[model samples]
Structure formats: C-alpha cells, structure tokens
Target: MTALQRIEQGSALQQTDDADLVARIDMLNAIGIALSSENDMPHLLERILIGAKQITRADAGTLYTINDQQKLNFEIVQTTSLGIKRGGSSARPVQLEPISLYRGNGSPNNKLVVTYCALNNKTVNLPDVYKENDTGFDFSGPRLFDKKMNYRTRSMLCVPMINHDGKTIGVIQLINKKSINGPVAFDDDDIHLLQSLASQAAIALTNKRLIDDLKALFDSFIKTIAASIDETSAHTGEHCRRVPYLTLALADAASRDQKCMKDFILNKQQRYNLEVASWLHDCGKLATPIHIVDKSTKLETVFDRIELIDTRFEVLKRDANIARLEALLEAGHDKDRIELIEKQYREEIKQLTDQRDTIRQCNIGAESMPPELKERIKQIAARTWRNCDDELVPFFSEDEINNLLIPYGTLNADERKIINDHIVVTNKMLASMQFPDEMASVPEYAGGHHERMDGKGYPLGLTREQMSVPARVMAIADVFEALTSWDRPYKKAKKLSEALAILGKMKQRNHIDPDLFDLFIRDKVYLPYAREFMDPELIDIDEPSEIPGYPFDMP
Candidate 1:
C-alpha cells in the first residue's frame, strides 16, 4: 500500500478508538456526578456499587466503607436478590437482601483475604475462584455459587477505595462478568479504568467527611460561646444557647420555602463561604455586652426597686397605727388601755405585707404584664426605696447583655441598639477578614443575617428579594440553633415543635419567609439535629406545637 493509504487507514482506526474513549469518559463523569451530588453516604454507595456492576457487566458486587480503625463497614445502602429465572420476567424492584456486613472482617477467618487489599491497596483480578491464586475472598463467591442457586464465579475483580489522604476508605468487589453464557475475567484495561473511578470516589467521600468535621467544630465553638454568655449573667445563663438553636430551626424551615443552598460549581472557596455564614451568624453577639444581654427583671441591676415599695408599706403602717391610737385616746381611752390600740398597729402591718406580696407576684412571672400591672409597678416604684445606695449599678457584664427593660429577647432599648449594632460589627469583621477570592462574598452573606423580609430588620434591612441564597441558609441555621440549644438562660429551650410553631407564625406574619417553614415541617430535619445535641431521653416526638403570639409583636 502507498504511505498515504496507510496513514488514512491508521487515522480511521484512531478515530474509532477516540469515539470509544469519549463514551467511557461520559460514563465516568456521570458516576462522579452521582457520587458527589449526595450528602447521604448510603445513597452515594448504592449508586457507585450499581455502576460498578453494570459498567463491568458483572452479576454481583459488594461495596465497603472503611473506617479510621482499618475496618470494613458494610453499607445497607446496597443489597442483593437471587433466584431470578431468566425466562420468568419479574415486575418488582430488586430487593437488596440484608447482607450481615461489618467493619473489618468480623473475626478475620473469612477467606476474602482482606489482607490482600490491605497490604497492597491495589486491584486483584481473578479468572475463576475454583483455580488460580486462592489467596482472597474469591473462595466465598464460588462457594455461594456451589451452595445456593446454581451459578459459578467465572471472573472476579477487587479494588481498594483510597481517599485523598492516601488512606483506604474501603474496597469495591465486582463478580462474574459474563462473556457468552459463561463468566469472563476482568482485563488489565478494565482494572485500570475501575481503579481510576475508585480514586475519584475516594476523594468525594473524603470531601464529605471534611464537611462533617467542620460542622462539628463550628458547633463546638458556638456551644462554648453560649456557655460564656450564660455564665456572664445570672438571669441570662441559658438565653444565648437557646436563641441560636431556635434560629437554626427557623432557618432550616425557611430554607425549604426559600432556596436550598446549592454547591456552587465545585468551588472549594464558595463551599467555605457557605459554612462561614452559618457558624458566625451569632458572632455578632460578641459585640453585645453581658449586662445588656441578660437583664431579666425590668428594675434589675440598679436596685431591687421592690425595696422602695416596702418602705412605703412601712410608712403607711406607721401612719395608720398613729391615727388608730390617736382616735382611741380622743375617745377617752387612757394610757392604761394603750395595749388595746396596739392591736390595730399589728393589723395595719399585716395588710401592708399582704399588698407588698401581691406586687412582687407579677414581677418575676415571664408573661407580659398588662397596663394594670404596669401601673401597679409604676405606683409602687414611685414610692422610692430610701435604702438604695448606688449610682446605677452597672448592669453590663462582659459576656451577658443584661438590660432588664429589654423585656427578654436579649437587649433593652439602648442595649438592643448595641446588640443590633453587632450587624455593623459583623459586617466590618467579615469584610476586613481575608478569604480566597472565590469566597469574597462571605461577608455579604454573613452580615445580612439581621436583615428582615419586610425591610424592617437592621443594618441593611435586606428584604427577601435582596438576600442571597447563602444568607437565607445562614438565617435558617442561625434561628434553628438558637431555639433548640440548651445553653441559653433567658428562656427555656424550645422543643422542635415549639420552635417550628413560632417560625410558622412568623412566616404567617411576614417576619420570616413561609416556604422554608413548610420544608422544616415536612422533612423532619430536626430529627438528626435532636440526636446531636439533646439527651436521647429528652427528645419528645409528641412535643406540642402550640405557639402563642408574642403580645408586643402581634398586630
């Protein structure tokens, strides 16, 4: 043949190979997409295990997830079914029969030569378990063929799943690739390609683990901060913890209605920004002072203004007794009869004590005080405690924001103003902090947390339309954590039921977006959350959903 003719024919062959290569790339890409898309590990494993069998045209396969202890953990995410007669066309989804699987070869006696992969961290391929190197788990596959419904293991391939850290997360085993009514062993090319896929899968799994670890760390830091806030104020001990939990719950519900955060184009930096937004939602609290945050009673810190009313009672008792004695004397009662007049003095004192007790009753109660109660407090406080020896006792503590007049969300008017100003603090804190260029938007997401749906929220007052999806997600996570946490002292920790109900009402009143609340209710997102922080015994699924409106916030 002419040289040109030879080159043309060679080009055609190369083109065919190129087309096949493209097809393989597409398949691998699809598998990678499936693996990385899910946060749930089992589902991800199922997808890969099924892909491994179908791509290799194998009859059965097993996927294992290895732990830090160098053990194999079988995922219930994948299962098997046998006894399918070729002509008996069945119409049911294949049942994944429960395979009793464990981490590490349970007693190390099984012949899957787990040691083979452990030592080599490489692929093992066999033409048949009945012959050849009998070193691995091959014995079990063929034995199953011999004992169960008649089938023989013709070829087997096993590959280690090594994460990015160069540690093996687990192994993937594919069995019996059929070639013309009999099994065919996997070739070098198949092993090489499968190895590549396994490597990619490992990286994805490692990514997920890192995410989980980061979240745990963030939660730990927030818990420590909440404890500090609690410790700073006598009355606000638990408030800091509870608010973040509630905020997170609310944010979770809101996300369902709002946009669920999307993994942005696999950008690591963007991923970081999303996480930062959630963890630092309450970093703004660091700017708020302790005395202002935990102020419980209206007249707290400066004095137990109640003491002033007691003084008034004492004066009233003295006046009443003096009058009663004077009347008795004017009526011709002599000094010898003074003991009879003294009885009236004792009765007056008893009445004043009873009235004082009633005034004290309404002060400590958590519920809202009506105008009558307010008026009563005003009248009694006006009476003056001549005993107060202070300049205004400093209510502001380092970690606690105790402003009694705050009426109990966390800050009083000036304190609330200071607390709200934390948005500015967060904005400045995050904006000045450097991040990789990809996550430059982190500060934007973090700072807008206090912004409201109605443009009434502080700092920016961003409406729902103006907020980014990341900010919305932060908003949910922030609210959920606040409501459900046990670290706050201002109020009792709200159960998932109470928190959701409150969020639902907020959504109804236009304070929070509604769609996210629906998602929070439907997905039971709090189930996993409850398992994380609360004692299992305290988790009450029957928690009441009755959310009474905040008297002041209600229209």
Candidate 2:
C-alpha cells in the first residue's frame, strides 16, 4: 500500500507541472501580441522585458545582439527592477561575441560568452551564477542592483533569438530569478516563456533589417538611372528629372478625383509601378540616334531638303539660258547675246532664292499622307539637287505624313513621326520588361500614356474607360512637363496661357480629360514641381518657353 501511494503522488506531481507549463504558454501568447503590435521598438522591448521577468521571477534582464564582427552587444531594450530604469533612449548595441564565439573552442576570456544557448540555439538555465566558473570573459550588462552593476552577477536563463534562416540575432539573458516569497527555480515554464518572446523579437529584427537594406538599394538605383538619362542630352535635362515629381503630383491628383479613378488609386503596388514608369518612360529615346531626336528642322538629318530646291534653281537657270540663246540665234542678235544670257542667269538665280520661301512655309497636314503632297513631290522631283543620305529612315513611319505638311510644331513631317513613335517605342520596350510582383502593372501604365479619351491615341488607343488611373496620371504629367519644361529641340514654348489653351482644346476634343486638366492647373501643380527640377533661368515666369525656346511645335 505504501509503495502504491508513493507512485500515485509522483503521477499527481507530474500532472501539476504540466498544467503549470500550459498556463505559462498562455501568458506568453498574451505578451507576444503586445510585442509584435508595438511599433515603438523601445516600448515593445520594455514590455517584453517586464513580461520575461514576470514569467521567470527574474530580478533583472538584459538583451544583447551579436554583431557581424561576432561581438556581444548590449541592447538594454528592456529591464525590470533590479531597480534600473531604461535610459530614455534605446541601448546602444555592441558585439563582444559572434556565433563563432559560442563554440567550445573560443576562450571565454578572449571574448564575451555565448554559452549553451548559442550552441544549441535554445535556452540555457543556470541556478546560480556565483557557483559556476566565470567562463573567463566579461559577462557584465548594466543592472539596477546596489553599488557597482558590474559587481552583481547571479543565475541567468538565456534564450537565443534565432530567425527562420537559422541565424542568431541576439540573446535574451534573464538574470537573478526572485520570487516574492523567496527565490524560485528558473524552471521549464520560465525557459519556455523566454524562448517564445525571443522568437518574436528575432522575426521583427530580421524584417526591419531586410526592409532597410531594400530601401537603400532602391534609392541608389533611382539616382544612378536618373544620372544616366541626364547624360544623354542637354535638352533632356530637367525634363526627365521632373517626371517623377510630376508623376507623384498627378497620382495625388488622381487620388482626389473621386471614384472615376477609384480603381487606379496608386495603392502600394501601383505606386511601385509609377516609380519605375516615371523613370523609364523615355528610355527608348536612349536608343534613338541623336540627330533624329534633335532634328530641329525638317532638313536636319543629312541634307536640308531646302538645299534640294536650290538645285531646282540651277535647272531653271539653265532653262532661261537655253531660251535666251535660242532667241538671240533666231534674231541674229549676237552683239549682246552672251551678255544677255549672263544677265538672264542672274535674274533666274534671284528668283530661285525666294523660291524656297514658299515651300518652307507650306501647309503640312496631320499624320495622314496627303495625295496632293504626293503629286507635289512629282513637281518638286524635277528640282532635285545634291542628295546625301536622304532616303534613310530618320523617324517613324507615317501613313500620309499629315503632320509633316502643316508644321504645327517645328517637326517637319518626318521628325514628327520619330517623336510620335517615342511612345510606341516606349510601349514595345516596356512590354518586354518584367517588373516584380509589386510593380507588375508598369508596362501597361507606361505604355498607355499616349492613349486618348476618345480612343484617338496611338499604339493602343485605349479610351478613357479602358485606361487606368496610373495611365491617365502619366498622360497629365507627360503633357505638363512638355509644356512647362525648359528644354526641347525646336519651337519657342507657348505662354502658359497658350499651352493650357492647347491642352484645353485637347480636352474639348475628347483627346484629354477636362476634369483632370482643370484639377492639374487649379492646384498649381507646376509651381513646386518647377522648383524641384527646373533650372533657375527656366523657372523664371517671363517666357519660361524662351529657356528651351518652346518649340514652334515640339515634335
């Protein structure tokens, strides 16, 4: 009977211990929520420290992170009344020992200690610090105990904060367990609680580190790309620089434009796309030969077409000479015939000089090719002169070279096509690109910049209904920069009044959204935008167009 009673008692004791362990698990859960939710790292650490002391009945606590150099560092992230209050700021981190220090080989005196906790990546319990050999290294962490903090050392229970990657970030050392009634064993319950909290802290620290690293890399990348594009040309100056600024502005504008743009609101993912789009919109221009982009006049490529007309003048001169020579022969008037032919030559030359004036101001049509112009080509073909690399594809293809005829802007027809195709190239280039999950929408948004409200845009003429908010925002920013920018190849910039008037007309034509334009100007979006990237001379309101000399009609 006595033996049986003793067995029953042992069983009961085991059950009680299990219950105690389970309760400790529940308490740790409560503390985990608090630690994880707290954005203030110091406060979270302090709360966690207090919870640790409560679980273990520890007299004090200290947390330390190991540095890349494998040194033990202090992070008095939290502590309880061995009576020290956390110094208002977060504790400076130190590294006295690394993961390397924890193995049995490193001299304990040669470096800070990483005991059993570091080796197994688990908790280590010591009933009394005074009884053990001092591992030959400094174990000092600040304390609130009487006298010198270094003088006090006691039993410690430490847990390593090992992240999912199996890297140990720091160690939580619970020192001097003390119960209200008296000292209690730093039992399994206490070990379990500290381990759980350490786990949570590990994840937070790892996440913070990853996020910081990514941000640094992204900023560096943005700066490098911007610098590279700026190096391309003097004209692309402030123009490219202002893209991101205005993109953000348009994003904000779109954000406030009610539900019409509700789906386009630049959430986290959309903003990421905008960031890449704004930087890379003109990337295709990088591939374009320099002369074409800056082809200030129609004849700019290799030979001025105007010069070809001069050759026609040569033909007309010969024709006049032939007529004079024939007339003199018939009249038997040789006395002044040679001199008369020479005078006729001079008169023909004078006529040809003004011959180019009419053609220079000829009416260029829209993108469409005009049959009349093709016929004119036949008449002008008779006047061909020096041809040098004239047939090369200087710009993009056009059906009828409509805009070429009108010269609404400086672009003679061909240069206009090259400029227009920039968007097409932008689309094709971006289409092949692969943005990460967070930025997957980039190709669509950047490519849609030229899209019109009435489906009149090129490449893909997605109507306003099909266009995304990001695309619309890009459109607004693109136009805003083109109008207000201080750099370009041709044509003096129109007054703000004129630029806005054109955009307003576009709005009326259903080529642009009226509400968005109104919002853009009314908000004075360009004021601060100009401040950010415009050169001092360009920013001056007095004919801001003169700096770049707003293209008579920018291609």
Candidate 3:
C-alpha cells in the first residue's frame, strides 16, 4: 500500500467520526427539548434512559430514582435483545426491590455500580464487567440476572444524574454497548455524552418534581379552605367536599357525550381548572356570618329568642292574674260576680297559653308560613305586656314579629340576601387572586353556580349563552348536592326520586342547563355519585324513567 492511500483512509475515518459527532450532538439537543416538555414522570424517566441508550448504542438500560427512604427504585427498564420492557407506561411492573443507599450500620452502600455512581456523583464505564476487578463494584447481581436469562453481561456504563443543586437524584446504567460486529466497550465519547444527558435529565426531573410538589401543596391548601368552611357550620357538613365530586363526575360525563358535547370536551388542564373551581366554589361562604349559615330556626341568632318570648308570656299571665285578683277583691264577696271574674281569668290564661304556643311554632320556620298564621303573629304582637322596668311594650318585638312571619325557610329576606351574597364574594375573592391563564376562568365557574339559565340568577345574572359549560355544570352539582345533603338544618334530605324530580323541574323552568341535566339523567351520572355520597336510604329510585327529567324510555 502507498503512503498516499493510507493517508486518504485515515482522513475518510476522521470525517466519518466528525459527521457522527455532529449527528449525536443534534440528537442530544432534540432529547433535551423532549425531556423538558414531558410532564408525566414515568414517561420522562423512560425518555431519559431511552435517549441515553440511543446516543451510546446500548442494547439494554435501566433507570433508577432515589426515593425519600434513601433507596434506589427502578423506574424504567428495557432490554432490546431480550425483548424485555417494564415500568414507565408499560403494563408490566418492575418486581425488583429497592437498593438501600445506606447499609444497616449507616454506612454508604457503594458496592453496586448504580449506587456507587449515585453516591459518588460520578460516571462509571466498564469495558468488561467479568474482567474489571480494580473498580470494586459487585457484578454478582448482574451476572446472576444474565445467567437466569442465558445472556452475557458486558460493556457497562453508569452515570449519576446531578441536578443544578449538585445533588445526585438518580442513576442511569447501560449494558452491552452494541456494534455492527457485536458488543463493544463504551468509549470516552459515550461517557461524555451520557454525563451531559444525565445533567439535562436531572434538571428536567427536578423541575417536574418541583412543579408537582407545588401543585400538590396548592391542592391541599384549597381542600383545607373548603374543610374549614364546612367546619364553620355544622349545617354545611360535607357540601363543599361533595359538590366537587359531583361536578367532576358530571363534567366527565358531558365530555364523553359525543352527540351533545362535541365542543364541551375538557383536556387535562381544563379538567384540573374545573376541579380547582369546584373546590373553591363556596369559598365566599367563609365570609358569611355563622349565625345565618347555621340558622336552624327563624328565631335563631346566637341563641333561640323563643325563651325570651316565653318569659314575656309568663309576665303577661301574671299581670292577668293580678287584675283578676284585684277585681275579685273589689267585688266584695258577690258570688255571681266572683264566678264571672274566675271564668274571665281562666279564659284569659288559656288564650295567653295558646298565643305562646303559636309563637313557639312560628319560630320553627316551616316550609311555608300561612297568611292566617302571619296575621295571628301580628295580632299577638299588638297585645301589651309590662317589662321589668314597669313600662308597657308590645307582646312581640318588631324584629321578633318579622322573624316569626318569615314566609319560608329559616332565613328572612335580609338573611337570604346575605346568604346569596356569598357567590358574589366568591367572585370577588377569586378575581383578586392572580391565577395562571389556564385557571383564569375559575372565578367565573365558581361564582356562576347560583346563576339561572334564563338570566334570572344573582350577582351578574349571566344567561345560558353568556356562561361557560363548566359554570352550568357546577350549578347543577351545587343544587343536587344541597338537595340531597342530610346535614342541612332547615330541611330533611330529599330522597333520590324527589331530588331528581326537583332537578327536572329546574331544567324545565330554565333554572339550570337543559342539556347538562338531560345528559345527567340519560347517562345515569347520579347513580355512582349517590352510591358514594348520598344516604343509602335516600337512594330509592329504581329506574331512569322514574326520574322527572329523564328524556329517554329505557327498555
């Protein structure tokens, strides 16, 4: 061979190596972009290991992450030659136990190559595991694994994934570097490339974990607020908790409804936003007065005022008895006159007792207050009684009379307004928050639960067209949860049939979203929700047709 020919051959090999280096650099750039974008932890971990294998031409690889217990857990495992795949989106589980970072004596366990790489935050490259004895890493586990699978363990490379903080979070180990001829040792280029890849992987992983931890903290904080609101009033019970469950369930059903909800589909981020909105729907109730929230009776404030009214009635009876006694003394033993005075006193006492009983019943705040009953309350209010200061006052105070005449439920008009204002406050509170773009609609969704479909709802009075689907879905969820909640002080929990019937009427009256309500019944979204949250005794409905708004006739 001529000297010129040999020089040309060397030049050709150098060019090929340069081209390969350029290609590998481009691949690394692409892999970095992918690792940064991947949100799923498992998929991200798998991608890191796979990308390292592709760059080094490795035949098999395993990825391990350090857990809180100071142990290495297998996150992703792949062996191309054996056709073995486990973990990281694969249905097959990684059945191996974790490798503890420390021994029982509290010393670092640096015997295993992966752990050694992790513990030392260093890269380990082995030309041949069977022949390499100076590095002092135990190869018995790999040898046993290879023997069990009838495969050879050779040409290994392990890299520590060090984050920006200089902490080794995990390790990536590659086995059997592949070549056109057969297995070959990983060289300096492979080690450098893998070390760079490991750094990028670590950063991506740390960022993802940090974001996940922040989200978890935010979620727990939101739930804690909801729980605190529930704890503020015994009457509210689990309304805050159950509404989110039903809201998500109904939203899921709507999303799956291809016919009606083609445009109503929610992606993962949208669903999460809706979940946040649902969790914070009643957050404004936190500002509500506890007396109104826990108003078990019409006369309920800090305490029931009926006892005060009862005492006033007793004073009136005492005055009537005093009048009868003075009249009898003035009669001077006229028998017929005495009998008539005694009759008048007895009749007066009975009437006072009946009026007191009537006031007591009125304070209970039944579903409806009859006009006659209201008039009776006014008549009782007109009667006079002397106070402890010896001044005559009306039998009932004006406030007492107003409370007793409440047309329906425990709350009077003012208290009802206060209760309804919670949604307004919720809007204000959520609006004050600096949410991300994805969650910008939270205030609207949470605040719109009280809105009517026909633009009759409070605060903003958004019509069906003005509101989003999530808001409408929340309206139905809120109403249904309230109707079926057993802990409400004013009313008994309605049976499933009764609640559905009322919901049907609401749909017909344009009080709630018509399509969502129909979807709710048709898809039987309430069944699982009822089973999970509703009282067992309240779940009495047997058929969809029995539900008031069910549009379909099941065969």
Candidate 4:
C-alpha cells in the first residue's frame, strides 16, 4: 500500500475513536442525570446496575450497598444470558447471605473481590477469573454459582463506589464484557466508564439515605407529639393514634369510589401527607386542661362537687331532727301533738332526701337536660340553708346550677369553647411549621376536621364547597373513631349500627361530607376498622339496609 493511503487510513480510525468517545460521554451524562433524579432506593440501585451494564456492554452485573452492620448487602442482581433478575423492584429476592466487611476474627475480609474493592476503595479488573491465578482474591463463590447455572465464569470487573466525602458506600461487579464476536475482557475504557458510573451512584445512594433518615426522624417526632397528647387523658388516650388509621383507610376507600369520587385520588406523596396530617390532627389538644378533657359529669371540676352537696343534705337533716325534738319537748309527751310532730319530721326528711337525690342525678350530665329538670334544680336552689358562719345561703351555687343545666354532653358553653379552641391552636401550630411542598396542605387537612358542611363549624367555619376532600375525609374519621372508642368516661361506646345511624343523621344535617359518608358506608370501610380497633360485640349491625340514612339503591 502507498504511504499516503496508510496515513489516510490511520486518520480515519482516529476520527472513529473520537466519535465513539463523544457518544460514550453523552451516555454517561444522561445516566448521571437519571441516577440523581431517582428518589426510590431500590429502583435507584437497580438502575445503577442496569446503567453500568449498558455502558460497558456487560452480560451481567450485581450492585451491593454497605449496610449499617458494615456488610455488603446484595441490592440488585441481573444476568442477561441467564434471564435471572433479583432484588430491587424484582419479585424475586436475593437469597444470598451478606458479605461481612470483617471476618469472625475481627479482621477485614479482603479475600473476596467485591469486599476488597470496597475496603481498599480500588477497582479490580480481571481479564478472566478462570485464567487469573495471581489476583489473590477468592473466586470460589462465582465458580460455584457458574457451576450451578451451567455458565462460564470469565471476564470480571469490580469497582468501589466512592462518594463526595471520600468514603466507599458500595460495590459494583460486572461480568463478561460482551462483543459481537464473543465474551471479552473489560479494558481501560470500560474501567473508567464504570468508575464514573459508580461515583454518581454513590452520591445518589448517600443522598437518598440522608433524606430517608431525616424523614424517619420527622415521622417519629410527629408520633411522639401525638402520643403525648394521648397521655393527657385516659378516656381519650387512643384518639390520636386511631384517627390516622381510620383516616387513611377511608381515604383509600374514597380513592377507589368511581361513582362520586371519580376525581378524588391520592398519589403516594399526597397519601403520605394525609397520613402525617392525620397524626398531627389533635396535636393542639396537648395544651387542653386535663380536668376538662376527662370531665365525666356536669358538676365535675377538680373532683365531683356532688359529694359536697351530700354534706349539705346531711346538715339539713340534722336541722330537721333538732326541730322535731324541740316540738316534742314543747308538747310534754302529749300523744296527738307528739304523733303530729313525728309525722312532720318524717315528711320533711323524705322531701329533703328526694331533693338530694334529684341534685345527684342532675350532676350526671346527659345528652339533653329537660326544662322541668332545670326548673326543679332552680326550685331546690331557692331553699336557704345555714352555713358554718350561720349565714343563710341557697342550697345550690349558681355555678353548679349552670353546670347542671348543660343541654348536651358534659361540657358547658365556656368549657366547650375551651375545647374547641384546640383546633385553632392546631392550625396555628401547623401553619408555623415549614413543611415540604408536598405536605403544605397538612395544616388545612388537620385543622378542618371539625368543620361542618353548612358553614357552622368552629375555628374556621369552612363550608363544604370551600373544604378539600381530604379535610372532609378526616372529619368523618374523627367522628367515627369518637363514636366507637370504648375508653370514653361519660358515654358507653356505641355499637357499629348505632354509630352508623348517628353518622347518617350527621350526613343528612350537612354536618359531614355526604358523598364521603356514603362512600364510607357503601364500601364498608368501617367494618375493617371496627374489627381491628373496636370491641367485637360492638359490631352488631346485621345488614347495611338496617343502618339509618343508608340509601338502599346506592351503587
């Protein structure tokens, strides 16, 4: 051949090399971006191995991450020739045991190639494992695997993944560099490309780990606050914990409802946010007074004031006995007069006993106080009794009268206001926090649980139109949990049938979301929750049709 022709041929070869180098660089850039963007650990690890194999044209690859125990854990394993895939997002799990960094004798286990690469922060490129006798690393495990799979064990490359902090985080092992002709060795270019991929993978893995650790810490902190709120009241101690489970369950059910909730769906992040919001829903109850929270009766404060009223009744009986004795002394044993005085004394004692019993019953608050009962309380309070100072005072205090006259539940207007203020505090507390963008709606979701659809709710009277679906879902969960919780002091836990009946009424009155309530009943979301958290006897509903407000034709 002519010298000029030879020079032209060499120039053409050099140009081809330059073009290939550019293509490989472009591929590396794309792979780096892909690795950094992945948030899921398993998928990221899998992608790292797959990307490595693609860049090096390898037949198989395995990715190993260093666990907290200083051991190499097989995160991803794939072999194209064998069509074997395990770990990561694969259904098949890696059954291989972890490679310990240290042996039983407390010495670094550098006998294996992957571990040696990780410990020394070096790369080992074996042209052929079968031919290499001076490498000083054990290939027995690969040999055994190859023997079992009926495959040749040749051409190995192991690279240590070193992060920005100059610490080795994992190892990547590639097998059998493949060409069009056959399996070949991993050359210098292959080593450099694998090293670059390993560096990016290391950073991605480390960032994910940091973010996960932070997330774990944040979740624990939120739960700790919830648990502290529960600790404030024995009667409602489980309220904070149970609401989250019920909220998530109902939310999931709503997501599946195609009829009414066709547009309602919670993505993974949104669902996570809802779960977090549910956990923090009642965090403000942490500031509520324990006395008011555990108030079991109308006249309850620090303790039951009914016992004090009992003392007063005893005082009145003593006064009546004194009067009866004085009258008998004046009559001087006159039979008719003595009989009349004794009869008068007995009637007075009976009336006072009746009045005392009435007061005791009123102190035990009910769902509603009868007007006649209130009048009765007032009448009894009008009667005067001598105090320790000998001054005449009404039988019942004004404060006690007001407490006994509470129309519903144990809390009076002022006490109820105090209780309602917790939602406001919850909103403020959550608003003050700088949550991530995905959880920005947590404050609204958590605080709006008490809101009514008719714009009559407290803290913020958000109408149904103004509230989000998650908020409404949380409201239903809150009420249902309260209704079925067995730990309440004043009222017994209602059976599932009764709770559903009441919830149905609530839906009709626009107190809760109608669609979500229907979905809750239609899907039987309450059944699983009831079975898990409620007493088995409380689940007494025989049929859905028996429940009040249940639409018989509901799809």
TM-score of 3: 0.96
Model 3 RMSD, rounded to 1 decimal:
1.8
Clashes of 2: 32
- Per-residue lDDT tens digits of candidate 2, residues 396-511? 12322332344344465466567678778777877776556767787777787778899988777789889776777788788867876656655555455555556767777888
52-134: candidate 4 lDDT, tens digit per residue: 99888899999998988999999899999999999989999999899999999899999999999999999999989988888
lDDT of 3: 0.91
Q: Write the per-residue lDDT of candidate 3 for residues 1-555, one digit (tens) a residue.
A: 799999999999999998998899899999999998999999999999999999999999999999999999999999999999999989998999999999999999999998888898988889999999888889899989998999998999999999888999999999999999889999999999999999999999999999999999999999999999999999999888999999999999999988777788788988999999999999999999999999999998999999999999898889899999999999998999999999999999999999999988888877788999989988888898788899988877788878888998899999999999998888889999999987888888898999999999988989999999999999999999998988888788889999998898888789999889888888899999999988898899866887754354442
Model 1 C-alpha lDDT versus the unseen true structure = 0.61
lDDT of 1 by residue, 328-420 (tens): 877574765566666766776785677678555543434344666555544544432222463333222222222222343433466558867
Which one wins by TM-score: 2 or 3? 3
Best by lDDT: 3
Task: Flag regions of model 2 displaced more than 4 Å.
Answer: 1-17, 23-76, 79-158, 162-167, 173-189, 192-235, 238-240, 253-266, 282-291, 302-406, 409-438, 492-501, 537-555
TM-score of each: 0.57, 0.63, 0.96, 0.97
The better-scoring model by lDDT among 3 and 4 is: 3
Whole-model Cα lDDT of every candidate shown, in order: 0.61, 0.64, 0.91, 0.90
Ranking by lDDT: 3, 4, 2, 1
Model 4, which residues run further than 4 Å from truth?
1-4, 549-552
